[model samples]
Target chain A: MKAIVVERGENTPSLIETPVPEPADGEALVRTLRVGIDGTDFEVLNGNHGGFPAGDDHQIIGHEAVGVVEDPNGTGLENGQLVVPTVRRPPEGSNEYFERGEPDMAPPGTYLERGIDGAHGFMSEYFTSPEEYLVTIPDEFAETGILVEPMSNTVKALEHAFASRSMFDWSPETALVLGNGPLGLLTLAMLDQTVERSYCLGRRDRPDPTIDIIDELGATYVDSRETPVSEIADVHEPVDFVYEATGYAKHAFETVEALAPNGVGVLLGIPEDWTFDIDGGRLHREIVLENKVILGSVNSHLRHFESAKESLARVPDWFTDDIITDVFSPINAEQALSSGNNRIKTVIEFDTR
Target chain B: MKAIVVERGENTPSLIETPVPEPADGEALVRTLRVGIDGTDFEVLNGNHGGFPAGDDHQIIGHEAVGVVEDPNGTGLENGQLVVPTVRRPPEGSNEYFERGEPDMAPPGTYLERGIDGAHGFMSEYFTSPEEYLVTIPDEFAETGILVEPMSNTVKALEHAFASRSMFDWSPETALVLGNGPLGLLTLAMLDQTVERSYCLGRRDRPDPTIDIIDELGATYVDSRETPVSEIADVHEPVDFVYEATGYAKHAFETVEALAPNGVGVLLGIPEDWTFDIDGGRLHREIVLENKVILGSVNSHLRHFESAKESLARVPDWFTDDIITDVFSPINAEQALSSGNNRIKTVIEFDTR
Candidate 1:
């Protein structure tokens, strides 16, 4: 069997030979179908962040993927069934928090995320996961099922934001999402169904594929490079909800200025250190007087995974074609990983064995 | 009638003569019995902040007070009935937000807060308010009902913080409150009946009256000077709920570091210009990965006012007496406004004129 591997502190990933994995008790063997390459994957490949599995010099890194259950082992999942496995797993086999049904809130160092942290990932010929961690997908979603894992996080972030706003009759009329990456575009797709006025901001200029997707979803695309987030409210209305996925450190603070009274800012970005001065005194006052809530959310729960599939079920099949820009076979995995070809979503497909 | 007036740009409050106010349609004339002076009053006296009523050179500065309805005038109020007049009024006599029953969340410049911004306050001998703005109290609360206005804001702040945590079964077991002023003490008093473990952090050394109030509420009094909020979790367990009322800008950010996973930090204090560099990058990560929510709250709604009265009804009578340190007549009003006495709450009182 072959696997995608990134050496410790390496800037590139390559294919390598590896032994096939066996299913353990209550776990089923899965043959990989497709693995998506996201910004996190690029970050892992560059060794900017994410930890390799302990006692191993290289990490099999890819958290977003769709696979077929090859050996059900009577785990209830049928062979040839499409499924999306979750990325995060509890450390020490399991912890009190995850055992209590909340692995997303696990404390630092107590959770080992597949591919992104201290465990082997699904970017291989075959992998194994316990029944509880795998979310079954509809047969119609077999080709684009890899998006469920990434899109589930967007669902959870919005769920957390709205949960915070349940005290009032909170119908957010306007929304601003501060990114145009795959996650940001997916967020816009979800908001398009609910929010009346929506905007997606990014660094690139107009006439891009991301902008085309935004237009297709009836959302306005704003180039953040020309119009900064601080000035967004001046050009448009103050937003009730801001889905921040840009991973820019300073935009987290700037979003405070763009929030409406009693607004909710859901931050999803994880950026490197880039400090800037802020009128924190004024920001503090707005939070106090205006009843504004800013919450940060990462990862997702099993329910969120279900929500992602439901959301995708509503959109047209061709819309997935707009989101998933390129697909490649395992022999040409390097092009999928290294290409800067205006790709929104790229994936490496594996032959089911 | 005598009134407490703050001249524009002046740092002192003085007694001034004013004509008795007349109630308009759907309004009632009230004679103030007691006007509670909290930190906002001191801040107004210092000319640090506070806006005068439109076209008025001086601001009548008092927001929290207990009074007697002097003239019912067909507004459904019995003469001599005990009531507390709300401090804020709609800027246009009524706005859509106020009409929709959420005056607390009204847009700025569209609302005027009596005593603090753009309206005369209850520090006057005779004031008039619409019946809708007056919250009636039981005769037993006459002497101490003045605490309701300030305490309602605390209730609302807690309400906002908890609303954000409603997605999970977020019954916080341990809580931390920053500050020992009236607002902070009131917060501790409210949490005494709910949370299992509570600690109030303040700069005052032991044996202080504030510490005694915290002790009486079965909450630990932590000297913040000895153990700053940044080091709080290092000493005690990670806090699940943080009520910040210290008016220190940095403590607002420090509380973020001390929050437990999925914790809530509710901010209340309005501080002056105090800025410090923060590892915002790290804080953002905590919010994203740990699913933390930080919200700021200031004013309270009519329902919150009703809730405050109900909360006051549940407490022992002598407890309120312990909280209000001094009450002054008109002749000694300057002392009430200027005295650097270690008073928890100071008030101006009038014989039921």
Candidate 2:
């Protein structure tokens, strides 16, 4: 099978022939259909993430993918069914993976190119994963099933936002999302049901159509270049909920400042450094005086993925194929990564036929 | 009337004779009883607080205080009534102290000594304030009314905690208090009704009776000097609610790190510097995986002060007068500030009679 392999760290991925995986017990062999490219994929290719090793070695590159089952190993998964697989495969029986005595591991070497010893990815003709990691896609999601992974992440963040208030009786009336990237835009979409007023903050000329989707979703847009966030917050009557997705430390501080007295700030972005300087005094004052909340969110859970799959079934109507500026065959993976167009999302289409 | 006055910036406060203030309409002349020393007072004394003008001399020390009304100008304030006044006193309909429409800005001039243009403070024989600021004490509370101010602050912190979750149905099963100061200890006492299990983190051998009271209140003590916080958290199963009252940034970060997934970390302590470092990745991961909340709190509302008065009415039974380590006449204000004993709370007992 032809696959995009990262031969060395900080090097462009190359097209190479690799052995196609077979279905093991409780696993399904999936023929690749569409694989999405994300920032994490770029990082993995550069050997910059904790999940991957420091030096670049041969690794397949893709986690956000959708494929049709070619063969099933008695896992009740039907052949020809489309599915999305889990990204992280923790060691089995470890307390870190499962809390309720469930098989929650993503299956060994299943994260496509990004796990312990990069496994062959769906950015090729075929890949195999455990039944537990695969969520069947609805027939209506055929056009946009590849977005399940990223959409599931947005779902995870929203779930965190909702869960933080699980013991409380209220929902956020207004939410401010501090970025207009793909994830941030998807966050805007996910929050449409929960937040009455949503604000998306971004640069002035980023041509990602998510901005249009944000406006279509009825969220206000704040161009960070033209207007200060403080002034925007003033007009918005102070945000009750803020989603920090800019991945910038300064935006994290500003999100806290932009919150209402008892507001909740959800930190979703991963800043480069472990250390971040925030206004501790102001945050302390807010906590004591107004009861403000600052929270953080990371990856998606299985439940989030399930809900995201259900949510993604409706994405084609909200966002069409036009949003995907370009699609490269697995052979042209380097070109897909190098093309710096203002595309909302890029996907690699494998010629399984 | 004898009072300690700051004549100019960076000048030591000197005892001097000043004319007794007469009660104007809607005002009360309170014969000073006791003043509690705090870091804020220390900042004010050193001319470091931005709230006061540095060059403008003739300022008075003390904000946390209790006294007896010698004269009442209407407003139904009774003479000889023991009371604690709210520190902020802004004129109605004035934006000088508060923003015109914002409730948070409605009250201004939190500095009792610096509020009315170098006004004399309750750290004197006599002090005058508006009747609206005075909170009446029960007849049984005269001897220990001095604690009403600090206790009220605890009430505010608790109120902020409760109000921040008012939108949600959250009732914390476990709570952690990250300080052993008077306010931190008082917060532990106040949390008795809300939290099931409480933990207080502080230094070992810090002789404050609040330790005993905290134990009495059913809270476990974790000596930061002896036990690493992570080990403590491993034993305690992660805190559901964390109150950071240590006024240390590092403590705040550690407290947040020790919180359970989906737990609330409330910032109540204000460090001197506004800057603090936080682990953004950990925070983001916690928020995403567990849906945790980080909250901030500050001074209380009028309702919180009223609750403090009610709580103080019962303090004699729970907290002994021994918490008041030393009592000084207004003339010895400098001596009270210099004493480095584990003074839980020091009160300046004015020779009001």
Candidate 3:
């Protein structure tokens, strides 16, 4: 088996030959199909994100991947079934925080590419994960299974935004999405069905096809480089909801300012540093007094995964092949990652069968 | 009528003779009885708090006061009834955010001594207020009516804490109140029924009677000047809820660190500066993994006033006249303001009848 592994913190990932992972009891050996690159992957490479365990060395790194069940160790998953594995894997013999049906609250352990000394990742021909971590992908969704991770994250953000407050009837009067990256566009797409109007802000101005898709979904596009986000409300009435996906601290402050009174701001992007200089006086006077909410959403929950699956059930009809800008073979992983091809989403294709 | 007036920003308040106010439609003329001093009053006196509408020279300088209704114009208030007036009054002919039943959401207006040109305050022999602003006080709660303002503010803080998240069931947990001022002690008293254990932190030695009351309520006291709060937590477990009443930015940071996982840090005390450096790394980690909450709480809602009235109704039975401290006549208002007698709560008893 061959996989992409990071030698150390702040180092480029390299493809190397590795032994095929074996399925233990209650675990599955997944033969890789596609792996996706995300901001979390970048953080893992830089040793910035807290998702990984301590004392890092050479390790497998990809978490967002779709694979086939090569072996299920009698855990009920049949061979040849497509699945997505959970990124977090709590250490064995840890407290019940992990075993008590809440893996998110569990202490850090051997996360793929994050921990687990010399572990092989899904980018390889074969990888192993706990059977509980695998979610079966429907046959119709296999082609675009790489999107499940990012879409599930968007679902989690929406769930957190709605859960923070009382269950009020949702009226998407207006929404302002504060980025045009892959995650940001997906956020706009997810919100397209809910909000009456949507605005997309991005850096590029070449009328990217993604922006065209957003426009086709009936959202207005504003090039952030040319227009100020603070003036968004002035241009398009006050935004009722703001989705901040820029992962930039300045955009976080500006998004809060753009939201209308009693609006909700959902923070999904994880920046390198957590320092954000918000206008506390303005936030206290306007955001709080106006009944607005600023909430954070990190990773996907089980329910969000289910919701994302349901949301993605329609992707086949809506997303054209061009939406997936680039696809690489497992051998060309470095070129796939470093290519500045205005790629919205790229995938690493593997053939383990 | 005689009143205390500030001519301009940073001007010293002076006793001045003014004409008695007459009740307008839906308004009332109240014979001022008791006035309570607040930190906001200090800010207005120094002309440092921005957003105050009153100019330096002609504004009356009090907000928290109890009075007798001399006349009511069809607002269902009977003459001679005791009432506490709401300091916030919206501008004329404007249906502001507050007028829509969101008092805290209301824009800046003539707020007692902070705004309102040439408006006589409760510091005067007589003053006028809207009928809606008057909160009727039961006859039994008259002696402690002046404390209602401060107590109501505490109630608002409690409300904000509860409103932020349903992360914890407060009844079975421990709470830490940082600061031993009147607000802090009052907050302890309020939480006595809600939390199982209370910890009071302060600098005072030779324990005061309030400390005795705290002890009587089964609360542990920590002298912060002599002992670090982190050490206290080691002895009696981390607090599930922390009320920061020290009015210092550094204390806010410390209180946040002292909170247990899934804890709520309520910032009830207001610091002068809006800009302050907090460790975003710590806050983000706490917020993300531990599910901790930090929220600001100020002023009071109508519900808080009602709760305060209900709670203070039993004060006379639970407390003694000694806790009432000194009662100075309105003529000695300046002396009362300057006394700094370590009084828990001092009231100006007006004789206007």
Q: Judged by lDDT, which candidate is best?
A: 1
> Model 2: per-residue lDDT, tens digit, A1-353?
88886775456888888788777888889888888887777776676544433344577778888888889878889989988887765443445334432222222222222331444456778888988778888866665787777777677556545554442333568888888777777777777777788899988664557667777889988888886666666766688888887776666657666876556777766656456767666556555455566766555656778888777655546454645667888777888987475777788988746
Docking level for model 2: acceptable
lDDT of 3 by residue, A1-353 (tens): 88887666445678888678677888888888888887666655665444333454566777778888888778889988989876655555545544554454332242223222234346677888887778888976666777787788778667655544432233558888888777877777788778888998987766577787777778888887677887787776778788878766556556656877556777665554465454454544454334455555555545556677787775545663656778888788778767465687787888734
Q: Each candidate: what lDDT? A: 0.84, 0.67, 0.66
Number of the predicted model whose TM-score against the real structure is largest: 1
Per-residue error at A172 for model 3, in Å?
7.8
DockQ (CA atoms), all models: 0.62, 0.25, 0.17
**Per-candidate TM vs. native?**
0.94, 0.66, 0.77
Task: Write model 3 residue lDDT over B1-353, tens digit each, in one string.
Answer: 87775556444566778789777888888888877666556665676444333343366767778888888767789988988876555555645444554454342342222232234456777777777677899865556777787788777666655654442223328899988776777778778778888899887776576677667768888888776665666766778788878765556556546777546676665554466544455444444444445555545656678788877764445553534567887667676666475576667777744
Lowest-scoring 10 consecutive residues by lDDT in candidate 1 chain A?
A271-280
lDDT score, candidate 1: 0.84
